[model samples]
Target: MPDTPTPLIWLAGATGLVGRALLTELGHEQPVLALLRRPDPSLPAQQQQQQQTALVDYAQPASFAALPAPSQVFIALGSTIAQAGSQAAFRAVDFDAVLTVARAARQAGARRCAVVSALGADPRSSVFYNRVKGEAEAALVALGFERLVIARPSLLDGERASLGQPARRGEQWALRLMRPIAGLIPAAWRPIRPERVARAMRLALAQEWAAVQVLESAELQTVGD
Candidate 1:
């Protein structure tokens, strides 16, 4: 690998809220290769011309060949089991897709892999969501990357496209009530901006750390703050 000041990065889920925020934070700092599930002509217009976009069908492992070799890989991949409508579909995106990318990055000689996970991710949890996240974290840990960072955030403070939904409304209300008393809340349970998470992810790759660092919400907020 070239001993360049800024390393090349491969970013998955570049269209998601956090992913897009990461791209913004990464702008002009390093060369970025953004991967999307399908070719979107509009994406080029939305992103800086210097950034490279690759169309990949993550469901098909063979499509990974379309991606360029990168020094680091950032995964912001996620899915709600509710939206997936099935447990299997949820795991497919949250776990399977990430593993595929991790394997590809390892093969491409990436120095590090950083991913955004959620809070309460325990593979042993009876709750399906946390179980999947925990399983994914375990899988990534086993990959033995030279540097691996997993960010687990709580009650992400971000806007949903659909604001009228009951869940969004409830979340907004809870955040409003908590924002005033955020200092009183435990570090692990405070709400954090998605942008903060994105910034932390970028820093994880840019900075040096001990092997297999798991960034709890407290650590993530500290970096983001």
Candidate 2:
């Protein structure tokens, strides 16, 4: 009898906070193919050797066509309206690009998927950001994956400077104000480390769940911890 082959995992947004942590978590245990907007020469030589990478233009559907099929896929792609420079640009990445990748992965034989979403995601949300996230979630459910894990994490805590990304002033200020009274805040609303979110995503995907499973920030803290 032959030994079973390790599963190949497809990861998008490999440079982002949660994505980076998830990559580290996957380590050398499973083969990984990281799809990125550009080359990241900064990746450690060992990790580079362990993980395959492909540069992709999320706006271009054809970019994902060449990707090899995988059993599982993870999407951490997202951007704030400010970073995107306009609401339309933000939607292009957060909604359109995300669904594009998901649709492509599903076409490539991926049965299980995990996606990072914001805390207040709701399709009917009056807030544009939340509305977009909600719409993405709804659309993913409609894709009919065998197993889907949606992580809704509150204000992600990570070192953006280390990733060569600009700091979000609002997040910085909120962290400062919340730190001293963190225990007083609701667990669901409190700041969560990107690593925790990453862990929760991995753990959730490992389970046998039917249809969709949503992991809230509070549950992420417990399960991820």
Candidate 3:
């Protein structure tokens, strides 16, 4: 919209920890077309220089047509089942909404898409969360992007509490305890930082790639480093 000649990047769900980190990682190298449900008035002036914010309506396919034709798309959109309040609600965001956006991305001529998923994803998984994530990945692969990168991270280390998403009472405490012992765990299952995940997403998009690639938590550490 700013009439910049730089290649475009369309980003969704940029309020998340990984998304926030990606914003910094993108820096002033390229312009990012940030898709937001509403404008963020708190955006820093420097960030405003590099990002062009667009108001998005999730249900309106027409809005997708107005977005810059991106060479790549990054989707960090996700939600907890508890926060969604029901499995159906969770699927709407994690699966249905994601699929919708992917379709739009494909139509927008984006050659590559990098999305955040979780470990242990399987379409046939009995676990609702894993099943939903898997379904999303499967759907995206079926969309036939020139390159599709799925980043599956384990427990993400971040200052979520600062955002009012305080650690819950159960496994969250265990994750905090395990964070120190991450080296003792399997690389694929180890906890990783949101920054690392963000870095991995950017790196994956920059490669001369075709077909699909899935990055486990362990692989993210090296790429991010």
Candidate 3 accuracy as TM-score: 0.90
All candidates: CA RMSD (Å)? 3.3, 1.5, 2.6
List, residue by residue over 100-205, the lDDT tens digit for candidate 3. Answer: 7788988888888999999888999999899999989999999999999999988787776554443555647868788889889888877788888998889887
Better of 1 and 3 by lDDT: 1
Number of the predicted model whose TM-score against the real structure is largest:
2
lDDT, candidates in the order shown: 0.83, 0.90, 0.82
- TM of each candidate vs. truth: 0.87, 0.95, 0.90
> Cα lDDT of model 2 overall?
0.90
- Of the candidates numbered 2 and 3, which has the greater lDDT value? 2
Give the candidates in order of lDDT, highest first: 2, 1, 3
Off by over 4 Å in 2: 1-5
**Residue 200 lDDT in candidate 1:** 85
Q: Residue by residue across 1-225, what tens digits does model 2's lDDT show?
A: 999767889999888888888888776458889999889876656788789899899989899898888889999998999989999999999999899989999999999999999999999999999999999999999998999999999988788878877888898899899888889989999898898998889988989977899998999989945
Question: Candidate 2, clashing residue pairs?
Answer: none
